[model samples]
Target: MKIIADLHTHTIASTHAYNTILEMVHYAAQAGLKAIALTDHGRRMPGAPGDWYFQNLATVPRRLEGVLVLRGIEMNIIDYEGNTDLEENAKNLDWAVASIHGGLMDPNVKPTVELCTELWLKVAQNPMVRVIGHSGTPQFAYDYEKVIPEFGRQGKLVEINEHSFLVRKSSVPNCKKIAEVCKKYGVPIVVDSDAHFCTELGVYPNAERMLKEIDFPEELIVNGDENRLYEYLRKYTKVLEEE
Candidate 1:
């Protein structure tokens, strides 16, 4: 499938990210992407945008350089209870990506993979979470069987982050497992560059290769079509409004 929308990206507003919204838009357009989401790091991260920044996202154009722009957050899962640091602002965004950011998740002395998986399952079940980003990271290990099936039932997407696979060596094996489980459960998967700069946007050839290697079905990749993406965005926006 030809993936056209990259739903996980970061802007300069996210501490370590190096791009601006305008720069991302330009790069996405040049790369022929139909849409992109600006999912800055959670408020807990140093130098992350403040509440006002997210609340004022309306000022940003929905369409920039002929590409749809989605305002979102990569919220940190702060506790085993599945609480996120940006709970108050989460419901107001265009999309929400609930993730385990290492520092935020409290293992509570257990620190077992099963315990972490259980916590993530709780986060996935939350209506506010639209996507579970970078689940393949060993640092925040989770059972794909339990998580993927439930995520599918809840209409949430599971991410195959390119950067995670590139930076975290252990992510390769886990990502393969994630793909297999997602396929088995008929869960939709989103491949993202997890790009922090404009030049990196929509650059997922490596991820595409991995998906192909796993023999993952094309239809399961959510970013494969623009029409479906717009439809999902509409539904997602409605959910945010009701929150």
Candidate 2:
């Protein structure tokens, strides 16, 4: 199976991520990817771009260097109630990937499976969320049986993030389990680079390997075919009308 689109990535605007938006897009084009999402970090992360940054994303061309560019955010889910750093003014973003991060949850508050499961159920109902990004961090494991089906019902693509393998190795085991559960429930999924640098754009060897090992069904992966991805964007996101 091939991933024609990579719907989660970071740029220099995220503060710690190393590449510029154009650099990442260029790499996506070079890698021969049909589409890519430039999802910088949302507010709440220290030094993350302000609301103005996301609000001004309309200025970015819908297509860049022959690659479809999705102007979006990897929004940090801030509480057990599933609140995120997404500002009202930034709601027009073409795509969104909700994620759990350090600053959002209190360090002393243990990440119990029950609490995390509750959190994600709320996220699944959010209209602004199109993808559930990298949610299998060992600390933030959720109740897969209950949530995976809801994710499918809500059209939220569960992400298999490549960066987790290299930077957050602890997530690997749960990621496989999540993929397995997603398959079991016929939940749609996306494989993303979650790339912090230009060189990593469109790279998904680790994520691909996990799915191949599980003999994951190609049709369930949103990015497995260009038309499948385009069909998803048309139904669930505000992308694809870009000229």
Compare the candidates by TM-score and give the number of the best one.
Answer: 2
lDDT scores in order: 0.82, 0.90
Q: Which candidate is the best by lDDT?
A: 2
**TM-score for all models, in order of appearance:** 0.93, 0.97
Q: lDDT for model 1, on a 0 to 1 scale?
A: 0.82
List of clashing residue pairs for candidate 1: none
lDDT of 2 at 56: 96
Regions of candidate 1 where Cα sits further than 4 Å from its true position: 107-110, 239-243
Point out where model 2 deviates above 4 Å. none
Q: How do the residues 1-243 of candidate 2 rate in per-residue lDDT, one tens digit apiece?
A: 778888999899998999888888899999989998889988888879999999999999998899998989999999999999899998999899999985568788888999999999999999999999998898898999999999999889999999999988999999999999999999999999998888887788899988999999999999989989989988877676655
Task: Give each model's clash number.
Answer: 0, 0
For model 1, how does the per-residue alpha-carbon lDDT over 40-123 read when each residue is reduced to its tens digit? Answer: 988887788888888888788788888888888898888777788875755667888888777655545545678777887788
Error of 2 at 239 (Å): 1.8
lDDT over C-alpha atoms for residue 232 of model 2: 91
